[model samples]
Target: MSRFVRQSYYRHVYGQPSKREMCFDNIKVSASAWDTNLAAANPKFLSVNYQASGGGAFLVVPLTHTGKLPDLYPLCRAHTAPVLDTSFSPFSDTLIASSGEDGKIVLTHIDEDRLTAALRLEKPEVNDLEPVLRLSGHVRKAGHVKWHPVAENVLASTSLEVKIWDVEKAACVVELPQQPDMVGSMSFNWTGTLLATTCKDKKLRIYDLRSGELTSMADSHTGIKGSRVEWMGRLDRICTTGFSKFSDRQVFVWNSGDISKGPIKQLTIDTSSGTLMPFWSDNDILFLAGKGDGNVRYYEYEADELHYLTEYKSSEPQRGMCWLPRRALNTQDCEIARAYKVTNNLVEPISFIVPRKSDSFQADIYPPALSGKPALSSSDFFAGKTAEPILVSLDNLSETAAPPIKSSLYASTPVVPGSGAVSPALPPSEPPAPRSISRAPSPVSTKHDPLPSSSPAIEQPPVSHQPPPSSIVAPSVDAHPEQRSSSSSADVDQLTKENQELKDELAEKDCVIRNLELQLEKFKTNQMKIIELSKNSLN
Candidate 1:
């Protein structure tokens, strides 16, 4: 019976397994542009657009679960042009802001049950919800629209120029003039104390929010320049990227203290034929750079150095990147979640795991004894009858097995004078013996045997060793005047050489200017002759 029971247990432990199941499904939707922008209201809610089979565009999926994106419920559909940017208000999860090429900015709320009911009931007749506000002041296509970080009712719109709107009053609060060309991007500092604007003119302008004054500016990349600027949340810095004329795409970190100064640090990559889109995380330590090459790169910022963390790839080019506010450290499972616009009409949101914790198999493992635990316990040896007894034998044991004496190497010892004790030795017996001296050989006579004395005797030198006064005076008289004149002459020669070079350069410039002047004069003479001939013909 026992053997049968053991066999049954083995069978139960090694039984055939059931097929695995997936938690989420791959959601497909139609977008207008090759890529669509994705925004999440919360961990459980996300929003995306879908191309209507009939025509135009619509905000189809209002709030879909992060785990699974079900069929979209058509909520709002009023724009004729493709939506360029969409953003959820940071202050309220229910409210969202969207701007399209139609130059309209619509603010709407997501009805929770209406969305779920429409999906459950398979109702295709979801109503067009009324927008809380419709902003309509942009002259050209509205490129981007963003809600103010600290202001609940303030929104910013960017096109050729930047305009701030007071939503409650439905009035433009301020109009920022464009710098000669179009404005590519704009962002407000974390505290909403400063505003940063990037232009197609290859310049970044910073404005003081309180005073509404232009504070500073920096030169940006000259080609494929960055259309976005993000101020580091907790740092006095800003990050931007664009393609350079040098055929290299670069991202720069500029210091807020001195904007006129060049970039504090920069990262360059050969995109070959792609573009780079960068986004800043909540804490700013992690920066997400998405390339058109279908790869997203993660970088850790330490001071001015950007350390490469890892890279994730997608089959399609990523159009937008955002860091969702994770609920907790454990819940923050991914570094960055991206949205890829695969086709001109389809957008797929993909999230890759950042893997904050390493896999156990790759880490070092230790035996039970070495795994941070006590090897043995005193109770094991002193337990009752249930414990095994330890045997003691006298036959082979050493009689004088002095309770294993520990070496004094690690033990402390007291000092004993004159015995080279543990303590440092006393100062040497006396001041070190004085060094001995040696006598010089005489010039007039041969050297004689030197005495082996303990110390050398002191003596004074003869006066004949000193130089005569007349010899010294004669040398000074011969050299002083010539030395002074030569020093002056060398200085004159250096000045002459510098002056000659300047004169030669000036002469060449003059020659070129004369040739230009002569050409101008001849052209003027021919123009006068033509004017005189025309006058004669008219008369």
Candidate 2:
């Protein structure tokens, strides 16, 4: 009754699930994603952390489906700390990158030839795994790694700093450093040009390669443990998950057009203890989020708001989880989304299928269909050239059916004319809104009629601390120092006004800080009350 298996799978990722009857049979593994930084699954293989007593191993298990690992056990071992995260390259079926406590980024090549041979031997087998390339740069544990969704030979990692690497050249091309705050999570926009990151300092920062570092930032969260970001496909909007001033888990939607204005949409997910990991489906129309628990909630993205669809419940709580690529899903079964959930000692597959009998192809999850080829240049990478990424549309819905948000960045055309390299998008409509935060002129413009019908020019995002792109000439302080006389009267007035504004800002911040401290104390008191109640019941 359940159909799910196709494509060449090179690895086995740990997942947990429960089904009606005979839908899925899970396999157990000694090495799991428990208390580890990562577990990932793509079309061909799976990567998970495998820790031994003396050292640590990053296992690349073949998804042989025989319910057993081939003779090649525990793939490879070489990390000083429990492996933090692993990512399979979107461009190559054989390449995977792993990072961890040792501050090492290892690119390992999977021996597909040997794996194919082992399958014919009548018993499962694994070949000796080794790193094909190693690049080290992070001073602290590299907590996460993500390959550019539409680019080849490119990867990004986060720890105390965010580094964009060109695997072909084995060099870090751009690095965004953070002090006094560690990055909790990072997600790239549909075009792979911008990255949204949530940090321990309770702020969300968006970084762009063209602009050297930290292009945008906003104060966010309060629990101070973890926060995460997910870019809504193709649109200029981004969704983030973090804590409130009282430590309650909340998810917020931001208009990157002017991040300083604050979140445009916010929701309180739950009071659960585990951090919430949110995933936006390739279709760009649905969102699924799972917390530290077994329940996974799905939502419909419509009219700039998230509408709850349903929740997937598992018998056991998952330690970690991952979603498979859209191309690899059983489209025939109306399967909209699939997740590999890692639990106690097993990884199971769970499918979110829609009920239908006509067997019609679902075009709503359709934008990812365009990313069939590698978009990055290997020669440019080897030459130490920081090439701009080729942007592709990942919008699964048609503009006629679903439209772009009121204040969203509207782009439906391709980056290269005749190439059809568009980021899936809903066509533009209406004018832009006044900035949510007042400061520099908004970098993205709405004044220009949507991108030309033929030529595609994606202006790079400006790097923080650097002069913004030359296109938007920002007014200089001395441009009109004195409109009245040669005395610079306007300049002196401007300074006096600026000083007053600064005083006002400081006073406002002080008041906000006092309010947050009070809330923290209040939460602590409630926690104490709950503890006392538990103690009395024990007595």
For this target, which candidate reaches the highest TM-score against the unseen true structure? 2
lDDT of 1 by residue, 1-539 (tens): 45553211012111111111211233333454422234333433455554443322445343243234334333455455766667766545666767667676766666666566655664233334334445666777676777665445557877777766554444455666656665767777744546898887889899754345688987877785444577765456788877788767777888766779888787786655455666665322344445455666666555466656556555656444444433211223322233333323333444433444543321111101101111112111111101111111122221221121122211223121121112222232221132222321111111212223332221111111223353233233444687766865776676667666765674465445434644775698899999999999999
**Residue range 193-256, candidate 2, lDDT tens digits:** 6788887788888876534457788887777557778887666678887777677778887877
Looking at candidate 1, the ten consecutive residues that score lowest on lDDT are 363-372
**Model 1, global lDDT:** 0.49
Kindly report which residue pairs in candidate 1 clash with one another.
Answer: 31-345, 35-341
> Per-prediction count of colliding residue pairs?
2, 24
Give the per-residue Cα lDDT of candidate 1 at 176.
Answer: 67
Clashes (candidate 2): 24
Please give the distance, in angstroms, between residue 529's alpha carbon in candidate 1 and its true position after superposition: 71
Stretches > 4 Å off in candidate 1:
1-41, 52-72, 327-539
